[model samples]
Target chain A: MNQIDLGMVDWARAQFALTAMYHWIFVPLTLGLSFLCAFYESLYVRTGKEAWKKIAKFWMTLFGINFAIGVATGIILEFEFGTNWSNYSWMVGDIFGAPLAVEGIVAFFLEATFFAVMFFGWNRVSKGFHLFSTWMVAIGSNLSALWILVANGWMQHPVGMIFNPDTARFEMQNFWEVLFSPVAIAKFTHTTSSSFIVGSLFVITVASWYLLKGRNTEMAKKSILVAAVFGLLSTAYAGLTGDESAYVNASTQPMKLAAYEGLYNGKAKADLVAIGILKGQKAPDDDTDPFLFDIKIPGLLSLLANRDAGSFVPGIKDLVYGNAQEKIVGVKAKMERGRMAVADLAAYKNARKSGDKAGSAMALQKFGVNQDYLGYGYFSQPEESIPPVKLTFYSFHLMVTLGCLFTLFFVVFLYLAYKNSLERHRGLLRLGVVSFFLGLLASQAGWVVAEAGRQPWVIQNYLPVHIGTSNIAAGNVQATFFMFLGLFTLLLLAEVKIMLKQINIGPEEV
Target chain B: MPGYSQNNIFFKWQRTVVRFYLDGFRAMTVGKALWKIILIKLFVMFAILKLFFFSDYLHTNFSTDQQRSDHVLEQITLQSKIQAVEDKK
Candidate 1:
């Protein structure tokens, strides 16, 4: 166990992160388009306008393509749970399985069933039914998001469940506790809005491009306007939700929050780094550099965490890296102490065999002293002995920068909308396209930071990463990873080709 | 081990061996095929009739809610060389 091969952890970390990234290319669109489709159909309902109707159909076509890819990418992720992280699955399957089953039974079917009607039932169904179909797709997508969030929230904050050593699984003791986790709620709200932002900006970007080319001017203008309004509002919400999510993390997953801020220790008044290197100290086993530069945060960190101008946030040094020596020493010393105690206990038993009660008692007392070593069993180490601080530091900046950009863009766009110049403001229209890419970039960076920061631990304070990977052949993982990787690439290519071709044509004239 | 004449017993043994291979083929090819996928979906929806009312699978395994909501600021750089590097258009 001590000299465990690290190859699996490396492979798994690479595979899961890669798969998630590819899967994500489709996810934001799912969350965003579902809402946009509903909005388009609602406009059609209110105005009885054929132009709005056409816009709804146009986006639906895009949504259908994205959804199919999303669904296909998603199934791979599920199988990966059992394939790559079988130990983690076995340990948490009971708790995790419930939510997964619910999503399949409810969300997938709801969306898929109604999605068909929304896509191909233009002449087959009534207008009201079609509208209902669009709404159901939105509901199904959101609901699917909700259930998955619940499970993930559990991983982050670990509520409503307790570990059973005999079965080596966490059993849910309270259903409601799992359902309404603080981390889950905050994350769900923040995440859904982010998706809305991605979707809105995506549609707006293409629509604006169409406008620039003067293709389908009437429909394109309307599409751009709808995307703008939703994009602005949703982007604003994404920021707000991110703040709420940060607050939740600050309170719950303090280690992650500290990592994000690159705080090495608790300070009197922490200056939030707008830019800086995140090199400090690494464990004895780690060989990372001790210096990085340019991390700069003024007072923004305090404001976000505590809503106070100068509240102290514990830096990673004080809690994680700062106490590294103690954790390692504590674990090692305790393990040795436990073994010594067991040996003493055996001696006591030997003495008793020779009919020496006093000597046996003395040995027993010594043995009792070492029993304290058992406590070391729970001292799980972080997955990465020393994190790639430079990568984490840069990714964090990228996420924060994109977040601030979206904030500014939405603020300005909202003002333009209120000024009734949303359509005419070509500057804002162009900015929306840039924001679309920025949002995607920010999301990717955010993901990188979150997964990398957790480093080493698949189950936070409970499981070491190397212990949690599947005990399968290396060749099996390589083969499947490559197979799926190839298939996913093909799917993504197909999606992009179709999307670009459709965007080139723009919406058909009403 | 059927109780019968020698000819009858021989025929039964042959049938059993044939059925074993048939079942093995069914599990490997048929059960794991796209047809099984369609069946699982159908059973979850059309046969059992609770697919719409159930929302558990999405919650645990494939929900965007968890991915989006739990944005842990950990940066993981993964190098994947599984596919031919194509343009990300």
Candidate 2:
């Protein structure tokens, strides 16, 4: 209960978000492009085609550029945990740091070792060994993603940890449970598959540029064919995993799900909003209409949430205020219990300091009873539990809409490429170039929905963000935030300049 | 089962891998630029950022692990005490 500095919290949050978003820009491309390189190399190995080797080598160059900058941004992200969010680190580092450490020790080393082999051993190694190296790099990069996502998923839905009153921390109880949590699995699949779509989009974008310019015609067609097919499959897989993520959110973080749908009133047969425009901000339980205009499918939300059209999906108001019929406990009640838990914890510490064993034990027992609602004690009011509705709603909808558009974009390009008439379609080729930016936008929007929608809480029900930040001067965090922004922007510009130069040099040169 | 010939083969394989990397690094085109970027970025991140901007506050302030844990405990428990007094008011 140290007096929280709102400014420090905001600055720290902004710094973390800025670093994460910048890191993400490079990660998805690395995730997908590595596999595409592997596929292209596999084709070269199988067919003994020089063209395929050139294609693989071209993509691999871009991948290497991206991969280097990704590691640069990623290292800083891990350090921020210790610097900006030391409280969260100290509280759950036992569990959270384990996966990240494994990622560095196991996955990173595997990637780094094979990456040297993949890039340098092209002519030196045998065909089989070279292909093996490429595949290893792909697996290693994705494995690195797996561990990072597992740590993030734990934050969103913390499991397999038990709170220790003695240390004032949550200690790991079951490592396997933490690793294999359903939320982690869904998040990994969804995030990595979406990354694959971004990779494919990048390939198609560069290839389409070539087609539009009437250069590298055969190479462009072949590259488009491979990327479109890969993108199509990844889009489908992403869709499936996206559905699983929504279903998991429905149960574990229903307020987030409610915010995504802009639901303020509970309903038995909730309709899923297909497209909507928000009128303005409305408080929970207010009579004002949340949406200015909209279209929706009846009972789809209930079906998505519970796999039953008739099942009730609670909304923001129902979650904020207790619903007797729905058996939903309000945030107000949770806050009360959380306050009791906090008070008892304080009493327990004081009693132990005074050497009153009986009094300490009594307070500890009361604390254990209400420990589940512990994070709620930090909030002053029930409505503090609600995340920004408009942001979450729009981000989720925009991501979904773009996901569908990418699917169609891939299908059309794939058809044109196979038909051997892709060069004739100037307009679609232009769209293909533009679609890469849209893919990046969709990927970023998905993160906004995931992170921004779960506002207030850093560890779901366990800890609020205000309590999780390190005790630091707001000015220090703000200064570092600008420093990182300037540094990352410079690096991003350098990466783009290098990538564009490589693209202009063309695959024939590669 | 192991013999001089087997040991010789293993040594030869290791030498081949080493030679491969050395030759590749020597015969670089774009890779030289990439290596420079990586080195410069790493220097900035570690030398400048880690040295000046970011520090592990708990580790810097507290000498012992126990002291750090105790500090966090104080922060959490102190909040509850303050809130309890406010509730009474």
Candidate 3:
């Protein structure tokens, strides 16, 4: 009710985004590299070859460098939830906290315990036990991802929670529903699989570097063989799960789906923008063309969204203004209903204090009817409902395009490696070395789409971000943002330096 | 007697595992660098940033859970009340 500090909210959002993006750089590598280490170790055990052991140990060392540096970055995010977004924390902490707590208490401990054994148990324990420890670390790290993604998934598509007006919180109605929500499962699979691609790329790139230098050629070849196969399979799974994500987006967050396609108007058959350049910014209701130059696959958007070429797909303008024939509720109407819900909630509280049972019941019922639109009440205009179209569109397109390229990159590398001609293709190996950075880019782009697309809402359709922010000064958040930037940059440099030094030393030294 | 023997064997195994880790860590080459990074990063994150910069607003300001909950509840409900008054005007 008091003029909300837009500056504070924006800074808080920026700070959270900065932390999350930096944290993501380390996470996917950990997720994917752990399994690759396990696979390499498994081969070592099977073959009883010192070369295989060396290769496995080499990758594991890199994984350790990454894992150690990445360890505490996530704790800052948790701190931010309580510091900058305390209101949002209180609102959904009951539901959101559950998954995060599980991740820490179960998955983190599992990973930490085995991680020591995996690193140091080579001579101390039996080969079987060491291999098992490696596999456990792999599983434990992914399980950690699973729980965090589940928490994030709940935010994008909130379900299995009942709003308790008495406590002013959303409490979990069913833990299973929260954990196994379709969005959560899709998110978990897509995220972890793509991470595997990043991990594979990292290994391939380092190995390619070795090949280029004409040093450790056998180990290089062996690393490429394992990584290329793993990368290719992961690429396929990431692609499949990515499609599933789009499908899920269409139903759960239509605005995001529309933004991904750069769709402006509703149509029975929408074309997917295969490649396009946006004509700068335009108002949601403007008559100007959205794109400058473009190529599109006919009816692909409709098919992707609704699983039918002929099925109608709504766009950004339609989402904001409403589509009559499509039976879509506009943000304006939702805002009115949301305002009514808010007022009714206040009135219900007042009535209860006055011991007016009848009045309280009436207000409570009205609130229930309009509760789904509660977040919309915070918006001052309908256009505020639309996420930043250009950012979302470009991020989505970049992720998709890079994904296609990664698939091709993997196939070619895999073929060359199998034929033992990878060494001969100098250019491809050079490209392979560069592809790791592209893989990181694609991974970041995916998060941009997921988080940026769901703008203004901390919890979809329930709480807007402005209200979610803590009543803190904008200056405080800005100062901390710079602090984090410096800290994360230092850590990133440390990680890169350590990893490079290890790579240069080669597996023979290990 | 069997359970006691099993427990003794388990303790022996645990001690060996602990010793294994201690010796391995002591003998580490690249791992020394990793441990340094971890310790420094943890100190920065927990000791400096958390201790000084970030604090749980509700917990720091409010002593009791009831007060915290009440404050949050008021924040959620108060905005609507103001909007209602504006609409009436």
| DockQ for each model | 0.02, 0.43, 0.44
lDDT of each: 0.64, 0.88, 0.89
Identify the leading candidate in terms of DockQ: 3
lDDT of 1 by residue, A1-510 (tens): 222234655666677777889888888889888989899989998999987888897888777667755565565566666666655666678788888889888775898678666765675568899899899999889889888888878877778886542234568898789989888888688778878878877886776666556566667667656776787787678778778877887777666766666665555456777866655555433444333666555777877887886877765544533444333232345445644654564565557658888987887777566643422222333222334555666787788777777666766755665565656777767776676787788778877776676554566545546555554555556655665577568667767776676666656621
Chain B alone, candidate 2, TM-score of 0.71
Clashes of 1: 53
What's each prediction's TM-score? 0.73, 0.96, 0.96
Between prediction 1 and prediction 2, the one with superior TM-score is 2
Please give the range of 10 consecutive residues that has the lowest summed lDDT in model 1 chain B: B73-82
Q: Candidate 3, residues A1-510: lDDT per residue as tens digits? A: 254567788899999999999999999999999999999999999999988998899899888889889987898999999999988888888997789889988775788888889988888789999999999999999998898899999999999999887777899999999999989999999999999999999989998999999999999988889898999999999999999999999999999998878898878888999999998768888967799999999999889888999999998999999988899989999989988988898888888779999999999999999999888876767887898889999999999999999999999998988999998999999998998999999999999999999996789999878778777889999999999999999999998998888888888788
Q: lDDT per residue, candidate 2, A214-306, as tens digits?
A: 988888889889999999999999999999999999999999999999998989899999999988668898857789899999999999999
TM-score of 3: 0.96
Considering DockQ, which of the candidate structures 1 and 3 is the better prediction for this target?
A: 3
Fnat values, candidates in order: 0.00, 0.49, 0.54
